[model samples]
Target: MSRPRLLLVYPATHKLGWVKRFQLPSLALKQVAAATPTDWEIVLVDEVHEDVPFDGNFDLVGITAMTHQAARAYEISDRFRSQGKTVVLGGIHPTVLPEEAGRHADAVVIGEAEPVWAGLLGDFLAGKLQPVYRAAIPDGGQLSIPWGRRDIFSGKQYLTTQTLQASRGCPYDCPFCITTNYFGKSFRYREPEDVLAELATFSGKLTVFLDDNILGDAARAKPILAGMRGMGLKWGGQANLRFAEDPEAVRLLADSGCIGIFVGIESMAGEHANHPKTGSRYSQAELIKRIRDTGVVVEASMIFGFDDHDEGVFERTVRFLEECKPSLPTFHILTPYPGTALFDQFDGEGRLLHKDWSRYDHGQVVFKPKLMTPEQLYQGWQQARWEAYRWPKIIDRVMQSPGKPVHLLYNLLRRGGISRPQ
Candidate 1:
């Protein structure tokens, strides 16, 4: 008379360094637990913190993966299936390449799992699970869905366990981004009251909003921020530079206890510098200053290996970071993930080096650069990290932020030799 047991896994890419280990809990896996039928017994495992139990007792196993984690995910699926357990694969990688994933999993849930999760579970219990279950784009009602289960990760050692999402999807379709293709081009937001109600449930001192762009829509973000003002918890999330142009929104963010933001300043040298979503009319230095002046830390994210970037990009990028003095300056090589326009273009031009899903991580060079060799691109990315995270530079960047304690702690972590490329 016992209910069926389900194992939910968030696969780890590899052993992370000290600083990278300070990651937020897997919001996607937790959300999947939220959507599962109440009658099922759920066990969540985030591989970043613990090892996967291949011999665990469970009737069904579910895993979520991105492009970088696909190889490990497939291996995990094979292991579970070898033990005569039913396995399900979901997330961007599987949703884009279902056939490849299906080669390993018994079923693949494509798109948002909320709409079809109940049905998928029902059919599974009925012994009639299908090979694929596709859910349509979610509407407003789906946006306000609650996390029915969080007890699975309640006591895990994470930098912060408080995570919430107020919205989904992005309207812009950047070539290197798969978000648009996966989540669609329309912004879907949960009601402000619903978001605040969820926030009120968290007892943590800090919260991390996992939205692709927390302020993608200014009107929707304002109310959410306003509601969070008196909550007395520090928060951070990703946002486009355009948020700076709206002074009111910037004020609301600070008033709402937003201590940090991750901004994608992808490329400062090319036509990308002029694109609407990421581009800014003001210089990078000015825009960063404007945001930082609001007592919020700016973690500037930049990408190299664009067609317009030459061999000198590494030093130039380091120089820009030094000049901008963001609280943290993170760099990445341009990775063309599957289902993205960049991937199609690279595949067509025969510029892709290999389809090794593991190396598709942004740290590795997966495609040939238009202006430099792959070696140069990889070296540039490493050199940028080396230069930016060096002790002197880290100290200088930390001094620039108004939130000195938090910035200093973050910089010290990077300097602790955690972020260096393996």
Candidate 2:
């Protein structure tokens, strides 16, 4: 007569130390927890911070995996299933390759869980659970889902537990990204009132929005930003850089308690995915300056290792970061994740080094470069990160931001990562 217990797991790839505090707890798991029926008792086990409770009593185990965590996820899922726990797999990796996931799971949920989760739970309780529960991607501009269950994250440390998504999906079908293919090709938003209402309950000042592009749609995003004007929260989120082209949007963003923003410059080659084909009259250097001038710290994300990139690409990227002087510059080696167009192109050409999902973390080189060897691609990535985080470069970046102290703190934190050998 006890309530059925559900365990949600976030599988860890490796041990994390001090940096664990800054990692965002799984927003995907939080969403999954939100969709469970009220009769179910929920528990979370983030393997990064705690051991999986294999000895604990639980009726259902839900494991979410990104591509990088897929190997770890399978290990955990296989262990739980061997012990007779009903394991289910979901999230991006499972959705991308459900058949691979099904070998270890009692069932798999494809696509977003919000629409299909309760039904899966009902069927499980009814003893009629199917092999897969697939939810359709939302194509509309509006989104409505329950507020995530923060109570489930009760004892966890994170950058902030105040993370929530104001929107889902992106209009841009950037070849390197999986967001558009799986989540839909539109800026689907929660009603502004719903998003604000959830924010009102947050007990902390630091929050993060987990959207691909929180400001992708100007009209829809404005209401949420306007409603947040007096909320007294300090927040950060990722969005496209082109959003800065509008002066008022930048002002409205800064006014809305946004302390930092991450924008993807994507590549050093002229193929920056987020920019329009017509191109803006203002250079990226100018747009970056506009956002930084608003006292909102801008973290420009750049990727290296396009087919055209040669040995000199690293120097060019470091120079670009110098001119832009973003509060932080995050460099990534290009990763062709499965389900992306880039992945198809690389796989078709037999360029993939291996199907080992664990190495697809963007920090490692998993494919042969068209112009350079894999070693060259990887060393260039490491050198660019080290080059950008050198104290002189860090100081140059920090001094440019209006929020000097915050910028300096983050730069030092980044420098530590860049200094650590991969």
Candidate 3:
């Protein structure tokens, strides 16, 4: 008798250097694997960091992919099907477009995978698999924590390999963002005790919290921070800027081993989510200073090319970032990824220039900018990135940051020399 084998595949893509080297375990897959019966043998393949061998024998294949990698994911699904093996597709893109995905997969798991995963596997073994299975959203409950699969990432070199999840979903429905659409308008939190227990497994210096919005709920965050401080761990994750509103929450996070956080500033001029018809969340200057005062370093992310932007946008954006003085500033062109509200807008307006998924990365302009020519949009993006990362500005930002000087210096040296696209 042989044990059932499961192959978990992460799709291949052309991406940033940081994304390629450190292929961390997908917590979504980990949770699904944890729910499987003991008789199954599992193997993980992250094509971004490793070579995926088709020769390996497996009873079932599960692949998770985003919009950019949908083409490659479908290719893999087709290849496995040709080999007379079962393939299942689930993730953000698939969950939103299940009807299209079901055409490629023998079965598709939608929404949260935990509640529906076991049933899907069971049905497959019983030869009663359905075309689509939806996971029930746990009401007033957090996700069940899985045991550490630390061995899975042992060979990979990421900035920090330790990964954990404490929360999910975003309350704001920004047109360009897919998070709110996938997770719902209301935020869901993990139990503080559960989060602490999960954090205890990693002995590494850096703990990455894989959450859409880490500090979404103030009440839940207080206890979670208390527990993290007790553990003495240094962690990072994405969060909303509104966390600065409550002084107590800020203090708790600093005490709880939070060295840095990534906040989506969206745009320097507060002109995101289309036009004045759609609401803008916060003013740029207020949000940046409030987060910095908490003693927690910030990595601010801003998007370019909102409808309101024009020729003057680049210089204004750079000045806003310089004044904010975040430890690191990430600038990206506005991208209309498939399944998002923005994608529909681009499609309707016939602004999309190409369907090449590789360039859909925030770096490239996949569509024409309404206010500027395609050439202007490209040049503006490159100029903004190069200017923001210049030596003098980098030094000033590092010097003003709240973290250890050595850490800041290390980042400065790491970023000292990088080529810009010609």
Candidate 4:
């Protein structure tokens, strides 16, 4: 009468080198394990920074994968299924294409998994697990499982492990984004008390929030900031530029130990600005000052390769970054990720360069550029990256940062070695 052996794995994929050192067992994976019956023995493997041991004896395997890692995840599923183990697939990629993933897995969970994982385990035990189990977005009573599996993250490059999400989903669905597709157009916030209790667990560690838009809820956000300030934990995360519009919000964020924020400005002026479906709310220059004034370092993201972009785009974008004087820049090529409005538009226009999932990452050009050749797009991206990461430019931005020196130093290191060849 042995208990079921549960295996949970996060699939491997290309990630920023800096982030690889900080990769931890995903909170979602831990939540699923938390919901499962205690009798079940669980093994967790984060493929990004750990090797998967094939010798484990597991009756059930669950994998979470993003679009870029779908191919590898399916391969793992196939290998495990060949060994007679039941495989379950979930996460953004599988949720969107359950039919395709169904080919490799015995079951696939669609959308948020908490409401579905327990019943899913029951179904598996009865040998009645359906091909697809759609998880209902939990009601207000749902308890967010605090991440408690730091043992799985030992021996990683970065020793600090701190992550807590105060909210889920984003209201503004930019055309190129798949966030709204997966999480929905409306944002749902965790109660402030719940979020603070979670934050309180971290004591003095540097936390990184995984929220898509932390400030999407102004009222809920203020209290969370106050709680974080009271907790005195240093943290960083993504938020739309509009968070800067409210001067009070900016001050609270800085007071709350927010050292930096990743802002996806998208483009200075091009397809992102003119795209019929884009929902971004501010111009580049105005948003820059607002964030700087808050004393939070800015890590601005920009994309190149709009139909309106010409050869001059690279220079213009670099100049814009210099003018903005943010702490860091993330230059990406326009990509049409599956399950997004942009993907549908690209499919309709027959403009995809290839269907290769690996190249679909923002770093690569996956489509023909309207105003430039594919080679031009690649070289332009490289040039822009080099320009943004150049030593002088990095130093200039760091010196201009209003946040703590440690954050500026981290930004400089994060943008390392991007200089172009002479």
Name the TM-score of candidate 3.
0.90
* TM-scores for every candidate against the unseen true structure: 0.94, 0.97, 0.90, 0.91
**Candidates 2 and 3: which is better by TM-score?**
2
Q: For residues 1-422, what per-residue lDDT tens digits would candidate 3 score against the true structure? A: 58889998888874446645544567766666666676888887777677666878998999887777777888888888988989999987788778877878898888877678888888988899888988654444554545545555556676665776787776666788877655666678877777777788777488888888788788877898887776868788888777766768778878888877888777755455443212336455566666666667788887888787797788888898888777778778889987788889999999998877657788778998889977787788778878888878877877765654744764564365445747
Task: Report the candidate with higher lDDT, 1 versus 4.
Answer: 1
Against the unseen true structure, what C-alpha lDDT does each candidate score?
0.84, 0.89, 0.75, 0.78
Question: What does candidate 4's lDDT look like per residue over 1-422, in tens digits?
Answer: 59899988877764455567655458777667766778898888877766676668888999988888888889889989988889999988888788988999999999877668888999989888889999764433323554445544555655366766777777667777887665766667877888887777786777888888888777778988988776778888888777777878888988999878888777774444554323436666667777776777888888888878888899989998888877788888998888887788878898897887856778888988788998898898898888777778877877765655865576667666466634
After superposition, candidate 2 runs with Cα above 4 Å error: 269-278, 420-422
- Model 2 per-residue lDDT tens digits across residues 1-422: 69999999999999999788988889999999999988899999999899999999999999999999999999999999898889999999999899999998999999999999999999999999999998887787578889988889889888778989999988778778888766898888999999999999986569999999899898899999999999898899998888888999999999999999998887743644343421667788898899999889898888888888888888989998898788899988899999898899999999999999999999999999988999999888888888888889988988878889999988888777766436
Lowest lDDT block of 10, candidate 4: 138-147
In candidate 3, position 24 carries an lDDT of 57
Of 1 and 2, the candidate ahead on TM-score is 2
Model 4 per-residue lDDT at 346: 79
Write down the RMSD of all candidates, one decimal each: 2.2, 1.6, 2.9, 2.8
Q: For candidate 3, what is the total of clashing residue pairs? A: 0
- RMSD in Å for candidate 2, one decimal? 1.6
Candidate 4 lDDT score relative to the true structure: 0.78
How many backbone clashes are present in model 4?
0
Compare the candidates by lDDT and give the number of the best one.
Answer: 2
Clashing pairs in 4: none
